[model samples]
Target chain A: MFEVRIHSRGGQGGVTAARLLALAAVRDGKYATAFPFYGAERRGAPVVSFVRIDDAPIRISSQIKKPDLVIVLDPSVMDVVDVLQGLKPGGRVLLNARERRDMKGYPTFTVDLTGIALREKLEVAGSPILNTPVLGALAKMGIVTMESAKSAITEMFSDPRNVSAAEAAYRELVA
Target chain B: MLTVATGNKAVAAAVKEAAPAVVAAYPITPQTEIVEQIAEYVSSGELKSQYIPVESEHSAMAACIGASVTGARTFTATSSHGLHYMHEMVNWAAGARLPIVMANVNRALGPGWNIWAEHTDAFQERDSGWLQVYVGSVQEAFDAVLMAFCIAEDERVLLPVMVNLDGFLLSHTMQPLEIEKAGDFIPPLHLPHAIDPQNPCGYGTLTGPDDYFRLRWDIERSMRDAVDVIRGTQERFARRFGRKYGMVDEYRCDDAEVVIVAAGTLGREAEVAVDLLRDEGTRAGSMRIRWFRPFPRLDLSGRDVVVIDRDYSFGFGGVLAKSIAATEGARPFSVIAGLGGQEVTYEDIAGFVRNRQPGRELWFGVNGDV
Candidate 1:
């Protein structure tokens, strides 16, 4: 089972991102699970969400320490937290920024999600979160399918507003 | 008899056929319709069982465990947060080896709060030693509930089974399902329930550290062995209902040089991609897993494997790929994609097939800007 660890501030959609990831897997007919570990479980606190994706049933049950893939949704998390602590030697890191990883440790890519989210109109009260836009980049980058990501978002939001916003974010990211 | 049915309705049919003596549940998102249908049966007197409509999900599973211990086949259903609220009871039921069966209309858990389908509910409960199964189409969800009962109640494997349903996909989505007649479903799997005066015994014993490990080991062993039962039970269900469910569903993979792995609803989408790829002469294949608990590794070997994981493992990527990697002596190329409910596309999948590695992981579709 492949575990994905996401780092974001509380309310930055880390947990939402995790669930969306699982829902996307569901859309693709893959056995997937997502959860998060937060100290305060409130807004603004640093947050981390975990996802286990597999073609088979998952058995290991522990907070993932070493991640095969680490996604830093919020750039500030890179400053305050150790995002690279437990990365596998050759693991790839996806960051939400315009600048690629200049730090020495691992392979990284920087996609300007705020720019995509703004174009896609996927903002909550003027705050353009990077989740869906990043998803779009992942799709273009040849990871999972865009349909599965869309399905996951559809599965996530009951509000058409949220769904449409996610779609816009996707379009903007791709655009 | 065989008739077109929705996924939730299929689960209800399976529960009815299992004929649990006492079924307790509270209506919650996606999972509500299940109890609604079963309640109809109870009211119509078509089924003989105590249908307890409790106030909450915790009470629902609580009633189920109490009934099971008292020698009644017990069942219930819930969604995301509801499952989280009653998460403790899930472990209690399985730890007690109560053999309870429930359907989770897989929903997203809340902080900002959402009522959509996702595996977070069951995913949070994976280590509880409860047998977990993910169904892709409504047909699989329909039959998984029946197969779950047969497997759960097997004296050799008396653990709770959570037949996870995609919230709206199966929970709210409509589909055609074939159900076996009552007689055909029951009889072979009637379980012995607890009765006050008839039989006296312990319900759930508090395990001390000494015997706890061994008891848990036994449970794990049963869980391991339950893999075969999962396949066997599905086979028997197919014999009766004319469908099939195995640990893994391999599509267009017989002659495939490159393979993509996933489970649940994504399997259908991946199937679409695989078909499109075949038409385009890519020779790509897909493997969707039905059983999430006993991860079937028999089919995963050295072939190029691209694991698409929706959930995130903090330190590593691709929980499924890692599980597969642990089994294989040689690792294939794997990519980590689809996180936080991101949409996965066919073109994205085609790209993976195009850049195919036998055993490597690629993490894509992410934003580095916040």
Candidate 2:
């Protein structure tokens, strides 16, 4: 089973990102489940969501303590939350940053999802939609096929910018 | 079509397929998504139903009963406080023998104010003459809702049905769901005693003391007869949709010496615990009680049982644990856990099996065994 933990602020669509990833995995002919860690969430409060993908139907519903991959949608949340706290030994980290950062020993992947969302003009109210663009980085990391990722995005969203933002992130991701 | 969706959306999807004539609901946390999705379907012309955004949950159920008596297929959804607020109408719907299907997102009753998964809310309605079915997955949620309409409307069992899904745990969780087109699986409702509003017939007439007990006994008689109806509906659903279900879902229990019994998602998680215990040479199994009201007869005579209850009765014992003891005569190790959505992992479930103490109660997360 491949478990993923996503960290982002409450209003940044972190939960939707988990759902999209799980949906993409399902489209790839695998079983998946996604859920959010409900807390006293507000606009800027740090929040977490989880996704589990496996060949068989996923049964475990508890929060993923040790995730195989950790994706940080907001690099600023890294200051308050330990994005690497319960990461497995061989786990990988994907960050929404313009440049790569040292993660001691873990393999880190960088993708400027915020820049891609803005470049594609994928803003909701006034914030760049990081959730859709992050799926492109996940696809680039071979977590899911680019085809399934785009399909999942279009299945839930109608705007063309969401797909463009994901495609841009898929090309710019430094894995 | 096979797709990924939350348990809430899955229920809404099934309701859409059933195409009820009326959907009257008031939204609440964890349960709001279900009514929202159904409302959207109605507004989008995908589902032709009278969607009533009721003022309160009481009015929600009341409107359903009002429409149901006039032979209209009705549906509604609610949660913890919303469910309690509609308590009177809940019993009225069942006592009146209205086949109104409801999806209740099970949540903890608040004193400190919490909105997470717990079975206490549904347990409170155990004897309301409603056939209760607790589901573990998004797919089961959809299937249960569809089958609920069939089971409730059967001539032999005209009782209401409540499909309970754990709040947040199942309601908010998204999983792969194969949406079945319930075309003709649920036949047209032919309510035997439906009142025609145009004729102006009096309904809910006062029951005199002489015949009150008989009326109550009739409810029980129909409740007992519902078992067969439920079985037939499930069997037909399986043959048509290719997915089968039963009153109890057993995992690895064929040759096991120890069994863990639970309901809802805890029941699904127990399967993983069974696998973990098997590696250590312990023959542990899991029996998930899907049907709560008109409870299925359990077969755990020789096995040592470990029962996990996500609900408590306060001053008594765990509702599930005590029910098993009363019916099966097995003194199970009652482990009270997951109240207000405290995380209960499969590892913890395996430990409960490892440390089996019959005839004892353990309040998990609190100190010792009582």
Candidate 3:
């Protein structure tokens, strides 16, 4: 079993990322669960979400604190918060940032999600959101299968053109 | 067959199916959708109900209470401060035993005023004499609504049932919700039968001090009886839809030396948290209290316990911890955390494992208040 936690502020696509990941896991014929921790019960506040995927039915009912993979939606969150509080020592960090060298220490990967959203002409930047971009980088880092992530994104978007653009951006981001 | 839906919609659809004659609710944030969907049903004539568009959350509850005593299947929805406004009738409906069903989208009660998911509002009404059942998903909300009607109308248990779900956590989320068609129950176990004025019976009648205590005690017995009725309803629901959500369901707590008991969304959150720890060799688990009124003693009969209360019982302490301490468990500790919508971070729960001691029930985080 593997757990993933996403650190994002209100309306930043943390919930969508977790759901997309879980749905992909489910599509992979593995058991999966995705849910968000409703924080401050408001927008623009730091919020966390949990996702679990396992070979067996996932039965434990709490949040994922010690996670194998932690994704941060906003780099500003790192300064105001210690997003790495409970990451497993050898775990991977995926950040939605433009630069990767500055995010030293642990194994880190970067993707400019805003840049991808802009390039793909995605709906309101907050809608198709950064989650899709981070998920693409998740594929590049070998955290989850790219094929699975691409397939998941294809299933998520309603328009064929956007789906094609997201897949293309995903490829461009990885390259 | 059960369909996936947000918990908010499930409860609303359940109320609609049961044929509640009078439906009233003001548009509060999270809970507003339940009544909004129900209003759609009424306007489309999909549900033969009187959709009363009220002006305030307080009146929504009051209208339900009053209509219920008139022997109408009554319903309403509210969250946080709106729930606070309806606090007075929370007891009024229960004392009157009006058998109304309300869906409280669990929101953090406020001084700072935030509208997110927490068990604060429902927890504040712990002793309100109303039956409270918290659901993990929208589907459970559907099951609870039907069970609430059956339990509340029972001759033994005539109390209102507040079927609660985490507001934004489950409310705004979309899912494929299965609603019972008009004749799905076969015999139509629909609500809102005649008030039987032919016999001129009295309802919401006055009770003097001499009879109040006995009446209250009897109400206690009725609540306990509801635990069994709730169990029976779960069984029936299973036969009808192959899903069983028991009152005191335990997961991985069997060989556990410690079990944290919680309700509503946190229980589900704890579910994900426990899975991660179990894989890492942590001997921790959780118990979800589906039925809050009866308190489900047998559920805690012999387990090392910690109570994760999302709300604080001012003047007292964490109700979950108190209930565990009062139940005489294996000297379990109570971890009071997540008060007033404060995030009970999953890490905060894991922290409970290494730091719990026996003597006093422990609170996870103490910020000014419990």
* The best candidate in terms of TM-score: 2
Q: Residue A135 error for model 2, in Å?
A: 1.3
lDDT of 1 at B85: 79
| lDDT by residue (tens digit), candidate 3, B35-63 | 88899999998899988988887788888
Question: On residues A77-152, what C-alpha lDDT tens digit does candidate 1 reach at each position?
Answer: 7778988878888876878776666645677766677666666566786687666555655555445678877665
Find the candidate with the highest DockQ and give its number. 2
Instruction: Give every collision pair in model 2.
Output: none
Worst 10 residues of 1 chain B by lDDT: B186-195
lDDT of 2 by residue, B1-370 (tens): 9999999999999999999999999999989999999999999999999999999999999999999998999999999999999999999999899999999999999997999999999999998999999999999999999999999999999999999999999999999999998889999999988888889955668999878889899999999999999999999999998888999999999999999999999999999999999999999999999999989888998999999999999999999999999999999999999999999999999999999899999989886589
Candidate 2 overall lDDT versus native: 0.95
Residue-wise lDDT of candidate 1 within B1-370, one digit each (tens)?
4333457878888777777788999888768889999999999987788999898888888989888876567789888888887888888888778888889887766666656555556766879989888887666776777778788988778788888877654564433345666465533433454458565765666768989998889889989889877777778777876776678888888888667787666665677678778998877888886777876774555466767665545566556766777875546556655443344566667776777665556666653211
Per-candidate total of colliding backbone pairs: 85, 0, 19
The model with the greatest lDDT is 2
In model 2 chain B, which range of ten residues has the least summed lDDT?
B201-210
Candidate 1 Cα outliers beyond 4 Å, as residue runs: A1-175, B1-4, B188-204, B329-342, B345-347, B355-365, B368-370
- Each candidate's fnat, listed in order, reads 0.00, 0.85, 0.19
At residue B312, what lDDT does model 1 achieve?
46
- TM-score for predicted model 2 compared with the true structure: 0.99
